[model samples]
Target: MKKLISLLLNRLTLVLLLILAQFIVLVWLINFFSNSWQNIQIALMVLSLLMVLYILTRNDNPEFKLAWVIPILAFPIFGGFFYLFFRAQNLNMKTRNHLYNVVKERQYILSQNIDYGLKGNYKKIETFLESDFWPSYKHTNSIFLPSGESKLKVLLEDLKKAEKFIFMEYFIITKSKMWDEILEVLIEKQKQGVEIRIMYDDFGSATKLPLGYYKKLRALGFKVISFNTLKVHLNFAMNYRDHRKIVVIDNKIGYTGGINIGDEYTNSTKTFGHWHDAAIKIEGDAVWTLTILFLENWRFSTKEKISYEDYYLDYKVEKPNGLYVPFGDLPLDKNHMAKDIYLSLISEANESIYISTPYLILDNEMVTALKLAAKSGIDVNIVIPGIPDKKMVYMVSESYVPELLLAGVKVYKYKPGFIHSKIIVVDRKVAMIGTSNLDYRSLYLHFENNIFLYDASSIIDMVDYFIETIADSVLITPQEMKKRNIFYRVIQTILRAFSPLL
Candidate 1:
């Protein structure tokens, strides 16, 4: 009977099963409601309707607002319940105020020493920031990698040198040789009373770590906490897992980007075939921003907010050599710092705009900006993973490729492996590298960071690295894209429609 059921089950059959389960759940809940329950349900339904209307009225993203409204109109009771579970995704006034203050305070400090002298021929970045983000920061040194292999080597070398503290946080951390080596170092550091702390998303590390892994780390004298631990009731929050990969050592050196703690990130996994990732290793005042970000998340998880004065140390002047500006993105913040920075770079580019990301699902504003940049004769290019780990996401990204092609933007697929790097280079003078992917989730839902490099030399090196990687890439032409099957075409349409939520 089980074999027969398995044989009969297909994609359509599975979807039907899910629909049936949802209907059953709806019916059961409605039937179980008492008179008072019904009244309370009516009140909740009214409140939900008002909220939906308010969201639709305020939000410019029609697709995102629609994602919330469709189910509610279809089945008010069930949809309202589901929406209630996921309501935290909507920004509240409190968080908005917090973001405003955080940005203000941060800008105040960063602007004190930031040098705007690095602005070369690119006028867009300078104008946008000098007007909006209040661009500040003294100096930043950039080391751009067109390859993940090289970045990992630098990261490991940095890790080996930690003396006082090591705080490593990533979306995913597997128990492989790559991590084992780092873990061994961290363990040794802990043994030497170096204060080792690690925070990994429970969902990302679910299959990699055992249930009692936190306790195991605690036993090893390493402070460890799993962010947003998986629970059936709090499943909505689980979807908004910490997608950031940050490493701060003694608040002096830091690293952040699309790289995770696994062999796949290092391109040793046969599953993803070849992986292309980018990460930056910074040694300067910029490390402090990453330090604060880690500490904030750590405080939220551990319930002990350390004083800012303790963490914010005055950086003694060494030289005007390296000025680092590190900024972060939060789900609650509407500023969209990562996207804003990327857009600024794209808009300001005169020579070129080069981007490498695993996912590419642009909102209307982002799409418009890229289109305008390409139309203005800027050499816009993007590199995506040839082999995608998520089929739906890949199809969705592929659907958007043609539009950019029409706008004269060249797209490349990393032939060797999956390209998981979230990096953008503008005019060979400015480089932005970090954990923020060019997708709605990274833009609006996840905690992310992007380090801005103001040094002209570093930006030039980054541009050179990107050019080198492009040599290993397979350029996608318009004619070749037409060869995809109808099934894939249909899937792409459906996935793209739902990309905002994905």
Candidate 2:
């Protein structure tokens, strides 16, 4: 009872603090404009009008559009200009040109060597690739690592064997014993002249890392770049973070997915016991794809154009018949690739749509699509975290479960710990594994990525793993939900109302 009160009070306090801060900031801006001899208020109103029009024409989301429009409407003089200076996605022409050139060069090489070999039995995936994503690169092997412990062991081994270079980028790299071990290896590799470049999101790791984390790494001969530094002035830019966990070693080995570099993922320490997560480490041609992703973000931060040719490797042996195209999903792009890929899989699913995510908040389209799939007799199973780090999000996710269950969807709560893996396997043929959560922020507001698999090997592996995971999960039946306390259900309903913001 005390814990609940504490949580509620903390939430209330946080809300009050935010409102106070916003009011003070707005007042200060208004006062400054009023006192200015330049008639800044009149100028800002005009700028804000232009900003609103630009946002209205470009962004289609009603929620986000309202978020911007409301502020500009309330405080026409300052809010509009403030948005123009910060909220705009207007990329500099030079940056756009650089991206175009890089993409063109990368695509040209991909065309010559790689072939999308979804020819015979993989026709469904082929249509998905071309129509949805314009996927042209192929003949890549993708392996799924179901257990976090298993993935961590293999990743450590791969890091040990890296000879030339190791490119590491993640949203979180804490100063734990796990990271200490990795740091030791990175330091040793740096001393040996192996090119090491580390990139991490500043805000994500801010509390966990010391002030001079990058400086320390640089001192050890490691090239480190901090993505989007922390400052109130840069808050708008900070929202669009590099949430990718990509590790490319010697341009031959690569790893990516939901797992970050921490003891929790390895199950060595139990913050939330039995941490469930997934990741993939790829060798051969796929590593090149990840290296490019790292280089693009690295260049954006450091302004150092690293050569893709240097990282590219030539495989002499006949590779496995798996087509892998690793693409980065950007907020700047009009098309939502991650959502589109999942939607395509859901649409083409004949038997089942299995998903496991920490966050289950969805837009109207996704909610409608899932309901339709469940009603059409397609087995749609969604596994969410039982013990969520954010209790409100957990409640919000649960609120949606009953409706899906009513429509023939099966929902499971991971009884062991937080289910952090974002995975989807469609009809045992298509698989999606990545850091993207099925939430508005990931799909629309933030940059995310996923690896789409076409082969039967990984799809079966992922499906089997999901099945085994359910053994430790509690199936949420409607009868059981009916027995829940009235107070608890009310909390869930209230939490779900704010699901869109989540």
- The candidate that wins on TM-score is 1
Residue 109, model 1: lDDT of: 49
The TM-score that candidate 2 achieves is 0.83
Model 2: weakest 10-residue lDDT segment is 230-239
Flag clash pairs in model 1: 114-137, 114-138, 139-323, 139-324, 140-323, 140-324, 274-417, 274-418, 276-418
lDDT of model 2, residue 3? 60
What value of lDDT does candidate 2 attain over all alpha carbons? 0.74
**Residue-level lDDT for 152 in candidate 2:** 68
| Reference-based lDDT, each prediction | 0.73, 0.74
Residue-wise C-alpha lDDT for candidate 1, range 59-125, written one tens digit per residue: 5467687777876767775466666656544434664565556656555644654455645444455
TM-score result, candidate 1: 0.83
* Residue ranges of candidate 2 with Cα displaced over 4 Å: 1-25, 28-56, 66-139, 234-237, 316-321, 479-500
